[model samples]
Target chain A: MKMKLRNFIILIIAVTFVSGGLFAQKKLTGLEIMKKVYNRPSPKEMEAKLTMTLISSSGSKRVRTIKQFIKDFGKVEKKIMFFLAPADVRNTSFMNWSYDDPNKDDDQWIYLPALKKVKRISSDSKGDYFMGSDFTYDDLGDRNPEEDNHKILRMEKVNGLDCYVIESTPKDEDYMYSKTITWVVKDRWYGVKKDFYDEDGEYLKTLTLKKAENIKGYWIIVTVEMFNKQKNHKTIMHLSDIKIDTGIPSRMFTERMMKRGL
Target chain B: MKKRFFTLIISLILIIWFGFADGLQITGYVRNYDGVLLNDDMDFSIVQNTLDLNFSMQTSKVGFKVNPYIYQYSDKTTVFDVREAYLDLFFNSFDLRIGKQQIIWGKADGVFITDIISPKDLTEFLLRDFEEIRMGVTAVKFDYYIGDNTFELVWVPVFSATKFPEQGSIWAVTPQFPIQPQFDFSRKDIKPSIKNSEIFAKYSVFSSAIDFEIMGGYTWDADPVIHTLKQIDPFTHQLLSLTAIPEHHRLTVAGGSFSTTLGPVVIRGEGAYYWGKYFQSEDPMLKEGVVEKDYLNYLLGADFTIKGIKFSTQFIQQYILDYDNFIVNNEVNNLMTFLARKDLLSGDTLHLELFSYFGLTDEDGLIRPKISYDITDGVNILLGANIFFGDKGMFGRFNKNDMVYVKIKYSF
Candidate 1:
């Protein structure tokens, strides 16, 4: 009986040390982790040439070429994208000005060469697809972390790297997605993978970052893929010739520039 | 003069090709249309070949665009025309455009209310697309941007009138009274000179929730005034020496348009008030005098998309002020239009569209259905048909003009 009690006490002491060590390591809240991911260091301005390949369920493919530009203006960020190839959508351009305030919606406009006019468009519907792609317009912009309730589910290994598995649920019930599960690389604060759930809590899509590169001390996503489970379709985006801190002028994101086409 | 103009255009093209080769972009389409009339057994068929050329170049502060069109009809008629040629100068807060251009200012579809700056071509009536029917005008436009508002001013030195269909054509309006039908009639168009040039101004504001614009203009009426004079024929003793003279009169227009989104649907509306508009009386006796009246035209429309299908509908109304019951048959006119479009294939390479228009007061309507397929990049094939129904109205008059057409286009 004495020997048995001694062994039990030793086991308890080991458990206490392990638990104490884990507690002393300082566990991060989900919000804190996401804040770090959101505030990750990035270039003030950037330009990239992207090739988008859309794949159908039957394996048919269509390709599109685009040029993208982004500039930061203290409290606001401006982005402009122009279609360069694919005769059908050639010369079509889209511009957006995103504000820091979550209450202030983004200002968006589209320029259709056929109409020779620049039309201001509403961006209230966050669920709408962007350019027939799996990504929504909200996905292209910076989403405020405060808009969602985030919780750390556990720690897991993704691509042989330690990551934090987080589940985020939108505060607004009318949101397009009921919840999103993200796997963020622990040390680098990179979102390596994400799973999107529909309003019914059904798995709808999966997004994976296939490639990432570090340039001038800034990490950039070079290749990404989104697969829509419901539609059996997928879209792959490959970004190249990326230049950061290029001093892109704020005027480049104007309606006049949209009409001009890149 | 025609030869000189063609030579000048060719020279300009050559200059652009050599001087600004890197900045120049040449893109247009070559299309062939084969149409056959469904009602008449008289072989009412037509074939047309069209080639459009557009050249544009832009720098940081200045830009220029030139478009030339060439058309050949099956009737052995060929014509060359310049659609647009303009030079743009940009400033920090304002921009100026000089030369010939097309300016559109309305929110209605398949109707004209505030979109009056550009004249229209009625050669094929309403069979062609509205964008194709709009002809450019030579003018100088200055746009000033202040905050979220844009102020635009336009001045046109030369006057251009709308082109109407040829006489004895299927789309011609038949007259009520007939005398010596063989009598020749001449038309005189009163064109405003530089001294009486046209001027227009508009102020527009764009917001996150809605966009709105207000505009006013003093210009010549796009419609012509018909002045019928009768003379006695010495041989027939019949009032057969009739002459119809068409003239343009001065008019003023004030209009505004607003567009906003309500949930997933977009709502748009436009209204225009015309002062001193000429209208022909239905009664032959009253037609001798040109009647001038003020009228208001308005349109309301909504568009939305559901499951990749887009649907749009619009309601239009025209009200004439101070209407004389004896002279005017109807004081108010109403019309409605609906359009639907759907795209098939993963990349939306195949498109289908249906459009319909109805005249509520006249009880006449038209339905047009079209399908287009992209054979390859920069190439497309389309099949469409126009069906008209009614017995005593505008569309009713063209019931026999129903036609089916096939078009193939190659763009570069």
Candidate 2:
């Protein structure tokens, strides 16, 4: 009995040491990974071209190839314009004049053909639907790490990939969403799933990342789905046939281009 | 024959314009309402049924609109106004329009979330099939861009009905006694033939941190008094001569709206002051001689939208500017005396004020919980029920005077 108790105590100590070693190993927090991955592209220095395909449940489909250019001055004013569409939407585009400062808000505009106007929609109204889509203008805006208050919850496996669970709360009260819970992969900082809560702290929407692929050394999202809980509406954006680093001009982001019938 | 000619023209225009569109968008709603008679205590019954049709082009290049309506009352069924016949032209930065349209001006609960000016009060005014502003007018609106912000300027010239009660209007006999000192008013002699005319301007700066908008405008009126008014003339030495005179009635309004972000909540606020030349008799000696000046109406409000639900609170005060010009009657005297007597016992002064509010959609949202309270008399309250549809759209309300109102509204 004494020998058995001694062996049991020895085994327990060994297991504790191994567990401690594993726990103490270097692991990146969610915020750190997000910051690193979000800054991976430069529209000015490095160029990337990509295509997205959106397949609807009713057997409808849409495709787009977006060519993005990043010019980093003191503040980052990234220009993301559309490159290809099935229709004659060659010059049709959107521009994001974003500032790196957390205190300052970003300026965004879309060239809408229906109104035949380039509307400068207020950033505070960014949470509204974009042309009846689930993605708000804010959702499509360039991600800035400093605008949100984030906390790393835990390390978990999502879609068979190791990911860090993160919770973020917007500092602005006018924001339509109260809090967002994101599941991001540790290696590439790609978000897998996100649960959005409204201002009243009620679960209002969900965004799911379906497929991810590596295209020309750039990680790209192949499929994405967004659902509005209260409105019973869903929008899916698909991206495929993506090629990065084809020369796009800075003049494409001008109002003259938007007025040229897309 | 005139009405039929107008209808035929409108129909032809709509059909011809719709035929040229590639994709058509049809959007409208039908409403049904049942209401109980308040005067006779009749049981709840069918009050109205309404149908509305809106057809537009997908491209929104060009379109025509028509809204026709009919209403059935207890004693009679009536075909009300068929308004909103207009041509919409969209240019690069300007929108030009002409027709019998709804031109909603003023920042007093308009355009942002509700139509406060065009149709007046939602529950009481719109619910009733009263004469809306059906004028043959033209408008040109320009939205200019400066960086990330936009500057909007709109000019509308309308020839419509009376804006306020004068010699021949319904509000001529009304009296003003406020619950607060901040709201005050004054009046002057005016002719009743003047129509409503004004130019509205708005400069708005929209941003995430601060959204600021300023609006101001003016209106005119001059007409004969419809209701009975105590009259006196200084030059003629006329004692209590009942007559009407052309008085210049003008109004000026200015206001601003601000919205800011505080942590996890969005705070929106707006306030405005309206100055006009309308007044009441302040002194018993000069009650019929001179009109008091400085009629004032101001409002302050705030609303918070958290999650999907919205909560709002607003306070409005209206008072007499020159108390000496107030013409008090037996009813007003009794009410005041009773209130003073009650205040002596309760240690609280009775003040006349009207408080109202809504939930969900300020007034433009889906569901409106609207209420009006008279703080002067035991806080008498009036509430509007759900709205139904018909040639005359229908809605019912229970008022403080034990009066029940069932109204039908129709607009083309």
Candidate 3:
């Protein structure tokens, strides 16, 4: 009995040391984690080639390719996308200027190759799906941390990485999604998975990060998939040939460049 | 041995052509379009097969594009059209384009308020696509860019007039003239000369607050006016055969357009004022039976989205200043347009759209409803209907032309 008790005490001590000293994690609020994600560092300039594949519920597939350029000017972030594949949309170009000021809405423009016209479009379509994809325009953009009320639901694991499971409710009651649950990877400063709920509080869609890479000391998302639970449709995006800090010219984001395809 | 030699020659030519074509980008579409009259036992009104092709090559400082289209009718008659063929030259702060090109302007939908750069083709009475209805002009266009602003100037060395329907065609309006009218062709054509050239200039600016454009043009009217010379018997007060003379006149115009967004709604406005305009007069007291006056055309529009559906509405007006009772055109003409679109089904492959134009002045309008389905990557099928309603106005004239159409298209 004495030997067994002594052995049990030593084992208990070892476990206590392991849990308290070696593997301890700093407790943080959900808002803090989301703030970290919102303030994550990004490249001043980036160029990427992306291929998007959309799959229907009946297992039909459609693919499109794009050559995209991005630049950050402290106060504004400008992006230009040129369609490079699919004959119908080939040479079609789109431009967007997203301002850092929360009060200022984004500006978008599209150039139709057939008409040779550049038209300004409303930016209020953030909640609308993009190019028939499961991902909404808001899903592809940045959201301020203050726009949501976040609470840490639990600590979990996602994609084999430790994550902070957080539930975020939008400040605007009439927003597209009633709430979104995100699995934020610990210390990586990025969300690996998210779940969206409709207004009735039923699950609507889910987004999962499939792959990522550490490029030039920067974490970059390589592939992602968005699945609509209600519609049984999904879209996958694979990003390739990512060049960071390439000093992209500001002139590349103009209406003239939208009409002049590369 | 001769056959072998010819095959080898053909293979060598193809190899050379493909080698040169590596730098060229080719895109085109093949479409089958059918239109049926609803009331004529669903009889086929028109059937057309189309092959539209576009080829382009671009470099850092130079580029060019060639667009050609062919339309074949049910009668085995084919019409070949060169839509646009242009060469582009790029500079540090400016670009120049020379050739047959189409320039689009303004923000109005289905209405031409300030978008008068290119003449239109009324052969089909606006039933054709806008791209097909607009005729390209051979001109030199220069665009200078400064930050978010652009200054454009276009010079047309040769005159290009609107394509009107031929006589005795189904689209022609049969008139009940007092006497059999004889036509004179002496002034029917505007000869190509520097003196007869047209010039247009525009300045556009894009800002966070709004997008706006200011423009001015000096050109000939695309439509001709008929000047009737009265003829009567000396002894008997009886009318004689009338000779109609159609002539184009100089027109001076100034216009501007603006677009802005307020929260979830977008607002657009466009207007143009003409200094010289000729109106047909039916009053016997007026000399020449025509009056020259100033004209105004304007449009106001708004677009919004609700429940994933996009909605757009517009109000347009055309005013003839100092209007006389004998003028054929109404002093104040009002028009309204509405468009709505939605996407449905998995991956949004199914689409629905409704567009309508309300001629408030004439109480005539056209309503178009369409359904589109994307079967595959580059294949699309569309089914649509055009309903015209009115008593005796523009659309009323086509009350019998209510049609149902289907279009199948393949792009590659």
Q: Find the candidate with the highest TM-score and give its number.
A: 3
Q: In CAPRI terms, where does candidate 1 land?
A: incorrect
- All candidates: DockQ: 0.19, 0.05, 0.50
TM-scores vs. true structure, each candidate? 0.84, 0.52, 0.93
Candidate 1: tens digits of C-alpha lDDT, residues B340-375 = 988675456678999999989899989999999877
* Top candidate when judged by DockQ against the true structure: 3
Worst 10 residues of 3 chain A by lDDT: A1-10
Each candidate: chain B TM-score: 0.91, 0.57, 0.94
Worst 10 residues of 2 chain A by lDDT: A1-10
Clashing pairs in 1: none
B84-150 per-residue lDDT for model 2 (tens digits): 5666665554445555555442223312211122323222232332223222234454555554344
Candidate 2 local lDDT, A186-254, one digit each (tens): 655557788999889999878887665554444455567777676555666654344444544444445
TM-score, chain B, predicted structure 1 = 0.91
Candidate closer to the true structure by TM-score (higher is better), 1 or 3 = 3
lDDT of candidate model 1 versus the reference? 0.77
